[model samples]
Target: MGLEPFSAEDPIFEDEDVLRDSHKPEDLLERDRELEEYQSALKPVIKGARPRNIFLYGQTGVGKTVATQLIMDRLQEDQEGYDNLYVRVVHVVCKNLNSSYQVAVKLVNEFRGPNNKVPTTGYPPDTIYEFLWEHLKDVDATHVLFVLDEVDAIGDDDDILYELPRANDNGNVPADETKVGVIGISNKFTFRDNLSARVKDSLCDEEIHFPPYDANQLRNILQQRAENAFVDGVLEDDIVPLAAAFAGQESGSARQALKLLFKAGDIARSRDLEKVKEEHVREAEPKIKESQVRNELESVPTQSHLTLYALLMLERQEDLPAKSSDIYEVYEIAAKRIDADVKTDRTIRDRLSQLKLKGFLDVDEHNEGPKGGSYYLYEFGDIRPDMVEEVLRDVDRLEDLFQKEITSY
Candidate 1:
């Protein structure tokens, strides 16, 4: 008998992860400049000199991390050919490690036995540094490069940024010790400017900016991902281009293109269709938006989440962007209702900036013609109210408000 609910016959996907954001494709399409810079930065490891502290800043899905990882792997592979070049790359995605203290602890624990790893919290920064130094002192590699992806998550803490590059200067490592280099990657463009002056001058020695993908570039990327992800003749003629156009026109993000194609196939497969088609893409759009909106809201800082939730509430009655003033008013009400302290209006504006940079929201400054000066308005970027309602349902106090007010509105 044939399969019932899930078909055993050959489906569209050969490997679904080929389009995943985290998947490191064997070759990156349409990012030659970025790949060259990534390789250039790591070249110093071959000469036993410290690589420049590289700051790779760009929008999400623009291939910053992918280019870096490719160079990192290549650096390690090339080391085997030369006895003198010992490049040990310790790359960590520091998105979840919020502060300098937590980052320090994480580096130390990387060398620790699983059972003896340090706790997520507690322990002084100095102690964590000493332990991290202890791990580095014994490393046989000639150079160590710490690739801190999403480095902005460390907040204003300069300890890790300053100390890692100047590890030898601080006596944490010996003079002839393994020279350390830092590669900081962030989607937040202003994160580099917000870094302490000294950290900027040192840690941001070389900077590379990755721009958003255009429609043609997104098509190229989507074609490559589809090549690896699905069988031949599985997708209709309009599927890839439609998904690419959608992603390019909106986010200009390759990740969005890949995910859209994947989701379209998923919709087709679920419907038992012979081929993935444009109608399946139409069905996948809102589903993808809901998941993306929910994930982005969850990833931001706690205050950003509060601000977003407040904006969602303000837009319930009228599905329009609320001004900064209006958002703050609703934010205060939300804070009191949730038993959270209200942040200053200035701080709320900064939160909006952060959220906008991360692509969760959009900020528009409109100039009133004659008498009125310009004021900023905020809207959830491609985020729908129902997605917000879905996430807010998990919050105890917000559930009633979402059920009664948001759903109806």
Candidate 2:
């Protein structure tokens, strides 16, 4: 073949739209059975009867939120003629609403809409719930459907989930009349197990488990996106399957799969290539992983970040693995520097364990019962020293901001 006068280093895509679409569950191909199951869960509300609370537990990006939203739209449309059906649905993401009172205040503010704002930390718990109850009554939202995505973030404070289902029973409304159903969505199956017995019994009337999509399923989903999202013949035949395989291997997340497709396309475009190929997908893997790591670093709880910052600082100063007691000193100083609330040493240790579980740090055990004696040490993993320094530098900027708040106080 004669030279086409194009750069060999560049790839050209047939179409670019496939790389840009945000996928919803309905957009997912070959998940009809799961979709039907989700639809069936909302069927009772259509007949104007009380709905059962639902718990949706699954891995991240497995279509939990998308499926819920899809079914909710159908329910709202179908229930238009049911006169007694005072159906109201509110979706709250609990990642940032870590406290029950914060959640209650958020619900009240959501109900109030544009006219009011609730302080994140200033409200009394009872007062906040009172407002929430009043708002529910005012809207005549007796059949209230509350979906708390990432319900695990609220930790020990599951009062919103527990009390919401029993709101009518507690005299907030008539005992058997004011129907409220909660759908708690969690990434961790252990979240329900950790809940108080009372809370678990009330909030988990019916549970729906969403499993990760397999490789073939991901291929079908990606193919569907390619058809609608990309221009004709823009993607090489292998690109879709390759992206699908990577996604399945990583976490079986459609979000991750779609992100990979987009990143590959961006790489193609930047290099002035005409079509995205399997090679582009390979090239984009590290970029995707780096972005994932960055997002994880950004989303950690403030206290956890403080603990990590302490470890990174200690590591910089010492050669050997550091013990908990030594790290606690650094953590206390870091917390005070940030003007952040300081938990007890045990609490900090627990936070460290949580971080380890999340795969951000590594813990080492040493024997010292006798001559060698007993000791344990901690070190960070996969997280590089340079990366640690960068995170700490950014956190120090945050410390400066916190100092301003202290002075204002």
Candidate 3:
């Protein structure tokens, strides 16, 4: 039976998420060389050679994620029936996890099945690590692949990266055992340079660098996404260049280009238009910018979180490097507005101190002449006042959605 077509006004592709996720690394195109290289690196481990640790460095959105997914897919397919091989690939994004303890807890939970739920906070690091090792040992896998993405975000916690590779190395391996490997992927090239010398020697045994995508690469990537997202010939010829140019101009990020293309397509389809246009692409720029700001805010520490909201309020109300007192007042107001507990001024001051340490906020010391009062002026380092305000609004809106459950629980 033929399916009835929707009215002419209805869009061809009813769902928008399909468009947004079309260029995901799993669905990535034209990266066969990289896929092959990474596969070759893993070939030794699959053949039972002592697994090695690898580090993948790349700029954001340049196909690091897509290439990793593609290679892992092939690895799984190739190793389907190797009973002696316990090949566990755990992927964790370190941005949301600030401490090694949190990362271990996440890893343990991922390794654990439904009956076991690890605690989120307050488990001693040693206990968590012990539990994780036991879980790994229980799985009896010959190879364990820990894929730590954005490793720098772990915030000075290098314990997991340091210990995982040496898991079976400590003489208790029954003299012969299958090995473990680590794959640490990061955008920060200097992350290893900053790590302790011991960590440097351990986790970075082998390295792969994924350079940013060129304009041609971005075009090819967008073309691949376009094929899956739109019906044949629905996307205009200019859309690919426009998306690729904008994305390449920013950071050679295929993800960013694909996001713009997806958004532009959404705009086109929403208007019941036949093709994406330059106007639609132009309109998507601000949306992407806003999204980036919101994501940054979400990743900031809780103290910096409140400080940003306070700074925003002060800026909107008056010019600022706002006196510490004025900023505190705004913070209190913001706390009440968001229904979060109002921390003491001392706590807020500590937050400001940490922000300064992290280079997000500047603290200017002032000493009045003779015995007069002395204090420090507070202001943001790189974040803008307006962007701060917008992120605060987004935070408040998201909080509103969950406030009831929060209060009830």
Candidate 4:
């Protein structure tokens, strides 16, 4: 019946924002090689030539976006001295924009600003592209570099990718007035690999790949961040190393490492502890993983959730690494329980493959020589079964199904 009083000034964190994704460090550590390559990719911009359409691909939490920001900042600042060159950098995050149409509209809105913003729909793709080109011309810059962050979210609909880089050649924008370029950033490596040949040839004029950090590199990054995030000496000696090791061993994600440090500090602060200790880091690991799994699940289709839930059922029954057929059976039952449509076995297999690609499942292909042929086995990947079940149970339609216990197949 009592609320704890908020502390006016107390320990754990000095500046928590530094540990977050939004915080852009002045210098990127341990990425000199990649940065050098990235600088080389952007060198044409400084010389007042047409900027290359740069493609940056890497796994999540690698410094792709951060590095792009740093280089973009430097590019803009350095270009200021060039009297003949007027450079403008436009950044658009395509995470929520799923298609080329949507991305073009987003760019149009970004270029047009608030007063002249257009609606999200109703415009044809060509019309949107026209609007984008007109806005690019109106900006009156000598060179315009558009940074499409999370460009993979546009998926296979890559019209913007193909068209943007060719706006000058295609005469959408006159080359003599303003030259346009694209700097696409993607966390998914497969996105670049799957691009159509024409789009790849246009958008990937210069490609830079960022490798994940190792444990030592992660430790160095953590130390740099912690120096700004946490109060001096409040973090135990082993705290940064432990968090870095957890993240490095798993995904080598700088974001995950920072999340662990932030969560551990949060735990310490909640307990009113003076220092973030090793135990706090250990305690934050599963929680961070669960949160990550939950966030990933939020984006997946409902059918993928059902497929994963089916796997969870098999995992609980110790029927792990079950075949797609077996998972299809469970998936049918679960789907029927919620009055959802039961997809075909082939569709379930497709879902399984997608889940595997998303790191939600581990798939093994079994070759059974002539007669037995080949089949695939499926099971949970790094994510735990309990975590999947817990997250799935939160789904409103599936909550009732989870209440019903199925002891047998």
- Candidate 3 C-alpha lDDT tens digits along 319-375: 567777888887776567666777889978877886666455777888898798788
lDDT of 4: 0.88
Higher TM-score: candidate 2 or 3?
A: 2
Cα error, residue 54 of model 3, in Å, equals 1.5
* lDDT value, candidate 1, whole model: 0.80
Worst 10-residue stretch by lDDT in candidate 3? 400-409
How many clashing pairs does model 4 include? 0
In order of appearance, the predictions have TM-scores of: 0.85, 0.82, 0.72, 0.87
* Per-model lDDT: 0.80, 0.76, 0.71, 0.88
Question: Model 4, 1-409: lDDT tens per residue?
Answer: 7997777675988889999999999799999999999899888889988888889999888999999899989988998888899888999889888899999888888877578899999977888988888888888789999999999888878999999999998999987889898999987766788899999899999888898899999999999999998888898899989999999997788999999999999999989899999999999999998787788776566688889888888888899999999999999998998889899998888888878887888988999999989988888888877778778888776776778878777
Q: What is the lDDT of candidate 3?
A: 0.71
**Residue 264 lDDT, candidate 1, scale 0-100:** 94
Which of the numbered candidates is closest to the native, going by highest TM-score? 4
Q: Decide which is better by lDDT, 3 or 4.
A: 4
Q: Write one digit per residue (lDDT tens) for candidate 1, span 1-409.
A: 8866755675778888888887998888898987887778767777777677888898788888888888888888888898877777788889878788888887887778889999977777778888888788888877878888888898877679998887877778874767778888998766777888888877888888899999889998898888888878888888888998888887788877888898899888777677998998888887776676676666666567678788776676674577888888777776766677789999999998877876768888899977898898888885666776576667554554455453421
Best first by TM-score, ranked: 4, 1, 2, 3
How far residue 194's Cα lies from its native spot in candidate 2, in Å, is 3.4
Stretches of candidate 1 off by over 4 Å are: 1-7, 312-326, 333-342, 352-383, 393-409
| lDDT by residue (tens digit), candidate 2, 281-315 | 99998788666766667666677788877777666
> C-alpha displacement of 271 in model 4, angstroms?
1.5
Clashing pairs in 4: none
